[model samples]
Target: MWHVIIFFWLLYYLIKPKYSRRSLYPPGPLALPLIGNLLSVWLGLKKYKYHHKLWQSWSQTYGNILGLRLGSINVVVVSGKDMIKEISSREVFEGRPDGFLYTMRSFGKKLGIVFADGRSWMNTRRVALKYLRNFGYGTRSMELIITEECLELVKLRKTDAGQPILVNQMFNISVVNILWRVVAGRRYDLNDDRLKRLCALVMRLFRLVDMSGGIISFMPFLRHVIPGLIGFTEMKSIHSSLQAFIKETIDEHRASIDVKNPRDVIDAFLMEMSTNQENAFTEEELHVVCLDMLEAGMETVANTAVFMLLYLVRDEGVQRRVQKEIDDVIGKRQPSLGDRSRMAYTEAVILETLRLSSVAAMGVPHRALDDAHLGGYLIPKGTCLLMAIHDLHNGEFWEDAGTFKPERFLTKEGNIIQDERLMAFGLGRRRCIGEGLAKSELFMFLTHILQKFFIRIPDGDPPPSLKPVDGLTLSAKPFRVIFVER
Candidate 1:
């Protein structure tokens, strides 16, 4: 009798015209009683290619900026570029949404530049920007580091000697080297145990966080009650390993601090901590910030390089053009940041790769703090906004959006034309702080590798399916490539 009553109540709620107040918001499939539209969205959890397909279908049926209930939680997916701009620019929508996974991971503490909001985010971002600028992000200091890493990458690939190499591994090593230099002022050995463990833990955490149907995300209390139900044990183990690694590194930096000159990110952070003891920034913040920087920097750059490799293997013509340009301008020597202007085709290829492959498919979600309007729709405060980067890469916004033609980026007269619609690093005030570093890393590494080796699908294997793996970051599936020495 009680079950019947509850069922009828839920039915009534579903049929009721409660959401009529916000009818102007984009339309979507009618959410059912308790489960809502979660079942439909969660259908492609196992296969990555289907995940984006599901979202695309939803947008096609409902219009851009559609709303749905993910097991009682409101999920607003903004597909259009104009809507993304409006939402991301507003303070009301500038904050990240509260989730069980985030709370558990950080224990409600916003440490890294990625999760920190408002004052902390602003302060940390400003500090990081200042430090990166001084460290030669736009200048020549960091470019030297990138060039060295690329050189090391080429040597490493040479060892494989025209055989299929897992390009992802090489990309990971190069990215980790760049990150290690920025954080600790030195690069790690290719076989460093600590670096390997750190990378593994980060990859695991990313997988856990990206999974859509995690119980912890919806039911925070389950973290305490059911424990195993939320995968808290694994989460706790990974967090402990990462936290310990960060704490030890920071302590080492503290012991070796040279007041006359700061070394790396740690040295700069310690200097700030010494001057500003009263503020919220603490040793704990420093530890988490280092962890955040490593995780964010590694995953983004590695996935990007992997995507570029996939494209090169799949399209021989595009590969040949880029390689020809590299050979003409850079010759046998490794490419450097200084060579970026001379290598226009290579630069355009990088841009086109970012466009064709949407790495950060649905960018970090933002919450609106105040009422805002975008794309003929009024977005109320507290509304969650999702920027669909994948949609932007396909829509009519760019000429020949479907094609992987780098020539589109080149002017009719053969000049590189910058396109603002490429928001892989995101847009507005909250754009990626490490954009300069990431750009340099991608350009130099790709040029160096292509110059020395020709990448092709492994013998007896079909061309790597350009399909991306699903996660918070859209990663490429494991594929091998033959590196024929140039």
Candidate 2:
């Protein structure tokens, strides 16, 4: 049969001698006939928690700067701090790839800030960030908003709680409220049907992307052929619903537009669109841009905070230290950015959690704009580049990186020692634009949490498994805990 012949040919391709001196690509495992390392990546994704470990191993064996052939593209992963910094800084590495799944979320075009590139990326990024900051995104006012949300969460939490609930779910609600206020100029209630639905849809998309080994991204055609496979059907259905909601929200914003007194990000963008037709400002662009902010703003820091809390729950000693630090600094008062300096241990613990989690493991891949030479190897134009942030934290770069020791980030004098390697939010020209706001939210929420209650295993229970579920962000599996009052 033809299928048998195809299988044998594919197996022969894998077993055949690989290209070596003839190719200029960096060293990596042998690639199969047409699929390249697609099978390897697919296998790794199937193993979820250990998938990152696989990539780390390759980085170790092939050296810090190495290449991987995933499907039709070649990826050069930079793991060394110096190499990543050197490469990510250049504009040549600032482009984004146009893959199937990557563009599918954007209505078959590169319309959003996250996956956007070149002139449009620069222009949109500038305006969006400028207005975001103007609306108190990273300032003291934003700190106050975060503090209010923290207090709200404290009230919502059950004292002497007997059951372990999904804290990240609680976090998503609060984070989305904050982001909604910034983006659309309003916050939603915990029971708001639209808000809850959007949150679920976002998680679905993240899970689908992760489950597919990102194969769906490059080989998007597979979705058309096998629509029901890999939760693809569910993801598309959810995406459609989310698109409708986004469109509705945009129309709502339009109904009450105030050009001179733009109320929030939506109003500000509408004003800009009204004035600047030459720029790529349209209703579709607005829809995707707002979508990008909502997803990024809600998930990144919130999930990172959950990872931190999960670790704290597993280690009572760390939790105690965090509480003691908070108590000493603020003495039961609500904590703020001002308190962060004195509470060095608390900050260190959170930072250590981020380094370990490597939430965005390999950050959204960057595309090379032009052919270039780096690390004594040629990087072809349009080739994809990935920064192995996870590998950077391995013991080779950080002392005893595998161990969860917050003390490493602290000096003997008890001050938090800042390390450039803690680029958990990333760095260079394409670093996360929302870093400042994310930090503010993380500090306020976790400190207030420790100030209010003690996190612990439920009575008559063993320690819960801390193994994280894989997705766009690595999150702790749903586990129960009792919120014992301090």
Candidate 3:
């Protein structure tokens, strides 16, 4: 057993980058012998916000860029605006880490836009952007879909009138509908078994990744040997389910392709496939892209909506101000993307919610393709780079960052000001593709819900704690809200 352990240790040392030899690597907690810093972020521990707290503490102790070890992997955590700009803007550090879990769970055999690096990523992203533009994402055509989803969501909330509703479910359903329209060109009923299972699986995976201490992440060698350590069985099942669903959807779209009038994203992708038979445009690639859209688009929008609703319930002053803005502009009509400018305060509320919530607290990890310098620290190639988005949201960059004040986004005279410090959608080339869609969904849904109902916290809870449950996303613990009919 000892010899076997020594052999694996030697192998890891050989394979991993030698960050310790680098003179300029940022200072951080001293990693233990073999375990590295894995024990500090144990996944099984309950109610621990190590990732968030660690980033906060590290920023204070070691400056903007801090280094740590997760087993043999060199992890670089970046905070502050200057450091973020320096890292994300560069092409070399643009790619994400190539890990076993990410490959298996996200890409599998498919080459989607999100996981595809270099030329493939560039091509896929270009096609996707062009297609989205053609489909009227930032224009009138997409607003119709957003309008329909918001109306449906508002109607559904009426059922829970005068009672606290789980806002997460409502947001989840609404966001899923929007993503469905974008991806598959069809929406599922709220109680659909497949939809429920898919949402649950995605949520579970988010939690796992946020707190992943699985053998695959910490000890890759034991992934096969220690079968129980990795959540392979569960992950495999989820992957199969997701792939099967995506494949069927793609097949249906292919069989009923109408070139003259493309229905949705799948139709657009099929058109791309027909035009570009060669290169990376495969059915497998198409499947992964659809999955990425569903997974990324759904949870983020939903989580933000939930946060917005929670804040509204907690703060009556902000709620009334937001509702007043909506009432003045929208009145009895359902809110749409067109009303964004007219509803300034409503938009401010959503922005403030994002600032406070910081969903996806530690923004997606970027891997250094080669040696990079930021804040006087050397970030060697293949080091897992994590951006402390939460710190930025709560840092000195914004006036009273910790407070949930929407007015900070508005001038004293009430003109709206766009702050670049709001890095919730991230920055630079790899910034979220769905930023426009997310903004539309967030604004439309929040306006409709607020206009239709008065939200309030339940009797006992203290405003559903602003402190988020740590993971890949900054998720709130299960909380309830009362939706009083307007």
TM-score of every prediction relative to native: 0.89, 0.91, 0.90
**Model 2, span 1-486: residue lDDT tens:** 999999999987776644332166777777787688878776765664455666777777888777777777777777778987877689899988776666777888887788899998888899888888888887777787787778878877754255666566668878877767878878776667778778877865776664223676656677778878755688778878878988888889899887878888888888888887787488888888888987887877767878777788889999988888888889966788898878889888878988887778777778888988778777788778877777776547677766678998999999988899888877787899888777778888889888988998776666655566667666667766677767
Write model 3 residue lDDT over 187-229, tens digit each, in one string.
8777677788888888777776552223476577766786555
Candidate models: Cα lDDT each:
0.75, 0.77, 0.77
Candidate number that wins on TM-score, 1 or 2? 2
Clash statistics: count for each candidate: 7, 2, 3
| Candidate 2 colliding pairs | 164-480, 164-481
Candidate 1's error at 245, in angstroms? 1.3
> Per-residue lDDT for 343 in model 3?
77
Off by over 4 Å in 2: 1-22, 44-49, 211-213
RMSD of each: 4.5, 5.6, 4.9
Q: Report the error of model 3 at residue 397, Å.
A: 4.0
